[model samples]
Target: MSETAREAILTRIRTGLAQPAPLPPRPDFTAPVHPPLAGDDEVLAFAQSFQGAGGEFYYCETRAQLAVQLATFRERQQLGRPFVWEPAMQEILRAAGVAFQADETEFLAHADWGLTSCEALVARTGSVLVSAASASGRRLSIYPDQHVVLARPSQVVAEIGDALRVMQQRYGTALPSMVSLTTGPSRTADIEKTLVLGAHGPRRISLFLLEDE
Candidate 1:
């Protein structure tokens, strides 16, 4: 329009801007969006959700049990020798009388079963949060045909958000360059809408929940 109409609009806008508008109340970011599960309930929820996502769940009440269960699983599945680079996991494997090759070259050549430790486990979505910060880095969880994660009960959380918070506290300002959540075996339904597992990564993902305080 006209200059008169534009002036009138400008004057109205100026008058409106003279008065401050009330701001909406701030949200409580600390509050969880969903109800949180705790203790054994949280672990149980994770087991159920993880299994629903086509993940194998093994609950070991003691470290000895974890070792024996893992040894038996490896034998039964014929997974060959596992490749673990994490020092803690290597120690566990050694204690369990499990043979694992830690050489990167050997792992790359024979990537059969890869064992790793996870950052956190989400009970809500049954997702395992892993970071490149670990000695195993990124490949151990994805390259192997059979990927096994050894997690402690203390690492289980109620939801993804909770897991993220825990990670933040653990890592502080120097967070990992790469962080990923593996819900289960890599899957996709891209071809003719047919579901396919191991489409982009490991075909099988197993979680060994070691009951450690």
Candidate 2:
């Protein structure tokens, strides 16, 4: 308020601004934050972690076996023909003698199940990394009541970092607009602390592991 007081405050501020503050140390991005998974048991580890998160895991020794397992699962579950959009997945279904719906309008109206392929499977956290870059896009993995993921053993990674690196390398500089990691079926405990499944996404998620390697 006083002229002398203002002058003294300005001088103090000038003195404080004379020296630059020291910057914090940079982190090592090369080293992983968590311990990397060891050995050749990534599939086993993924299966364990995935099942622990309420996901169903089926290991198919071959594509033929995968077809049989898929057909059996469909019949056992009494589910209608699943909605599949990806051309690769459509071919696999057609070759396997499995009927699927590919119509977008029909899918939006009524679809009991949907089939998709993930970008990568994290062995440590049992999370499936999906992106809009794939043909499945966003809806197929979320809209259906039951979501089935077709994955190969080679796609399983040691950790989340490894999965992210795989995506980055695959896409290079042109990355996808949206990338998501789904751990399990959608669930929420927000309503009166009652856990309800399928609140935000598919109620059931099944992973069919095809042993191509």
Candidate 3:
């Protein structure tokens, strides 16, 4: 084609492209549902359903109870499963033969456990959110084969929004690098119609609820 004709064709193409594409419809975001905290007993019951599906649970009232829990947890770890906890509980786990490491790299390779302080627990969803600023690195929860969390009943709330609000209030200026809301073990149904657990994260999750002595 001649230079003038080619130039004209290019200008037309540019103009057509500049006209802008039509926008798709917006998704609906409004819905009525109960908050996480609204149904405490029911949610706890639901969480319990996940038990024995390659998971465990413990309730404690004292340091001695903690010891017993650790004993059982240690047995699970010896069987090639991993666990997670809060740094505050490190000494107990250490006594139980579970190694403690601060760095995620070390923890992922050598340690079968991780420790993290949670921001809040949502009873409605049986979910807990771990802030990155907490002693337990975010990766600790997701990278292990099993997750063990320590949370007080008082820390459990009704909804996810309540947890977010607590985080905003507690950390007024600085927010955590990441906040993870984990309800159960890592799972996927992507493989040929079979539901598989622990695909991208922990295959099991256990919660230790400690009552004040």
Candidate 4:
């Protein structure tokens, strides 16, 4: 080979060697078997985790019991009209003789409580899976002083994977704009490492689980 040709080939080889090699593909675990969804076990696990994360859990079997619970809660907290985002909640409030408004965002801003239905309550992590596309908007869950969730026993799932499957079955290929997995109230220890509640969202989160079918 001519000297110029040999040097050109060496320069090309050197340039290729200087480039970094690509990283390997991430590994995927083999399909692991998970236990069947046990209703009682799931509820127990969720309650434990929820209370541990500073959340209040109320289990009621009847509507009358729920009404009484709300009445006591209202009297103790001295809460006025609450902002309700879901139709089911509106119906419940009307039946319970409680006042609620869904007219505007300003109402929700000053509202003491915000009521909404969750897509799923995850047992493994005690998370409430919420979708922006649902009746409960993004603000309803985050803006109110107290974020109240009205969930049914049928909505409770075994794990996050099951919760995701529920969403998939609900929305199909069309997904929501935003999905949140809230485990507890809005808390942060960012500043000075001192914990603070209601820093970025509601100070308190309460879940009212209904044993309704």
Off by over 4 Å in 2: 1-32, 36-39
Q: Best to worst by lDDT, what's the order?
A: 2, 1, 4, 3
**Which residue segments of model 4 deviate by more than 4 Å?**
1-28, 31-40, 105-109
Candidate 4 lDDT score relative to the true structure: 0.83
Per-residue lDDT of 1-213 in model 4, one digit per residue for the tens? 999999999999999899968989876576545565455677888887788888899987877777878777778888876788778778876776766786665773477888888889888778889878867789888888998888887887878889999999999999888888998999999999999999998999999887875
Query: TM-score of the candidate numbered 4?
Result: 0.79
**Which lDDT tens digits does candidate 2 get at residues 7-119?**
99999899889976777899998877877566679999999999999999999887688889998999999998888889988987787777888778677777789999999
Estimate the lDDT of model 3: 0.67
Could you list the CA RMSD of all candidates, in the order they appear? 6.0, 6.7, 10.2, 8.0
Query: All candidates' TM-scores?
Result: 0.81, 0.82, 0.68, 0.79
Name the candidate that leads on lDDT.
Answer: 2
Q: Which run of 10 residues does model 4 get worst, by summed lDDT?
A: 30-39
lDDT of prediction 2 = 0.89
Per-residue lDDT of 161-186 in model 1, one digit per residue for the tens? Answer: 88899889999989999899999899
What local lDDT does model 2 show for residue 127?
Answer: 95
